[model samples]
Target chain A: MDPINFVILAAILFAIGSAAVLLRRNAIIAFMGVELMLNAANLSLVSFSRIHGEIDGQVMAFFVMVVAAAEVVVGLAIIIAVFRARQTISLDEPSELKG
Target chain B: MVNPLLFWIIAALTVIPSLSLLFARKAVHVAMAIVLVMVGLAAAYVALGAPFLGVVQIVVYTGAVMMLFLFVLMLVGVDQREDLKETIKGQRWIGLLAAGGLGAFLVSVVARVALPVQEETVGEPDVIAEVLFQRYVLVIEVLGFLLITAAVGALVLTHAPRLKPRRTQLEVQRDRVRVGANPVNKPMPGVYARHNALDVPALDPEGQPIEDSVSRVLKIRHQTQDGAEFRAQLEDPARKDTEEGR
Candidate 1:
């Protein structure tokens, strides 16, 4: 596929994911949006890396996958703890940490 | 031609569900939307010729990570009653202003700046790795350490003391009784033993005298049968009353 086509599709996915992350109230859903955004960036990065015929992008993408996995584990654990303590999963209620 | 058309179709598929993620009130539905987005992205990655990354992205991000998220959410019982509200205050105005400013800046820059001149094409994947491991090895090692620390941290956080049902008051009292002590409805050590002396006989099934005799504890009514009760003093008050009356 042409790099331009790849770039455009990725941009659209990223934008939509950004909107979801910003607009949603549910933390899980917001988390999904974040995943969407990351994948969007990954799509573009891998595509361009291929265009340039470089393996670094694939390796970086691998690192990103690992990091994203770690993030989900830690992030969800925290979210679970927060929900346990607060008795709610609404991201809005956690705003008490505002300083 | 087919590749571009397929890319556009996949983009549409990706965008629509991602938008749905924002609007859906139910968290599970939103999770489904996110799964759709991840699958779409993997397809996009495949289309871009990075099949390996595409598979890893799906396996790690969608299969492992998101599943963990869903599992935790389910385990924690995040139901419809959780009452999700927007955390960001005045976000609408901020988002609007930021978007507008970025758009205006882009327009001005696009008008003034020439299109980027492409750099001389770099060769194969090995070159990228050569640069990375050669110069950026320290950064890579740090990232690995960061991930290990994170995994351990997550393990500690989620592995809290399991929520076993708490021991009930009766169970506690029963335990005390079985241990030859009174846990409730009685004073400190020796006091309750003395108090229940006349009524309870200061002994269990086997015969033995109780210690620490007291007058006050003898007043409580003890039931010998259903709907029948008598004062502890009834058993031994004559000895005490005869002396006191004299």
Candidate 2:
């Protein structure tokens, strides 16, 4: 079986994740959408790693996970602060930051 | 090379639950579904020969990230209904259309690209470490710094500034007395000599039921028993003599 199939799956997951980000109104759900996108990218990286017989892609994926974890912490904290002030977690709630 | 059966299984596991992210109404249900998808993704990584990543995915995504998400969900109120009213007219339809178009475009692009598939490459921790420590050592140190900054940044972001000076115990007591509140602890619920139920109010020295001694919640719920009824039973010679008396 070709490892390329995994790359295709990654693409599908990426699309789904992007849709989630675009469609969902909840900030935390949108945040999870961002996570799904990152996971999709990591999947592609690992799949490419296997196709190329190199360990570098897997290493890149590891870095992505670390960065993503950090991002989650900061992003969620911001969400918490927003929720505390507004008493709502809806993305539609805060229009003050809308550009 | 991964098994087709395995691929289908992992696909179903992830895609089905991932769909819940789009359609699930409850934020908590969406969260649990994502946890399922994360676990499924871990299985996919393991199948792709990145066992270390698979392990890390489970530990980091399921164990930590999703837990934090749930913590925030709880903090933000579990029943906080999503304001589904579209502030932007036709936004939902537009979003769906745009996403569908994006999915179609990506599928087409990926399908057109033909890549050479080689032998099964198992991502051993040793090879990963060699590349990581030798080539990506600086990146590793930078990530550590990033993590520390993130931790501090979160603390800074969520920290609530003190809006007023902390009230001292003396001040609190003084305010209570000023408001005509009992400086001493309020009498606890339940007559110790009689029934000790929280719904039973304590008898004051005058043999009257002190209604405030019972919890406000018990009274609101209509679960409070009449302390006077118990007292009446003890005092009633007529209740003991009559068949109709409760």
Off by over 4 Å in 2: B190-194, B205-207, B227-246
Provide per-model DockQ scores.
0.33, 0.78
Number of the top-ranking candidate, with lDDT as the measure: 2
Clashes per candidate (backbone, < 3 Å):
1, 0
lDDT score, candidate 2 = 0.88
| TM-scores of all candidate predictions against the true structure | 0.64, 0.91
Clash pairs, model 2 backbone: none
Candidate 2 lDDT, B118-163, residue by residue in tens: 6766777786788899999999999999999999999999999999
CA lDDT, every model vs. true structure: 0.65, 0.88
Q: Fnat of each prediction?
A: 0.46, 0.75
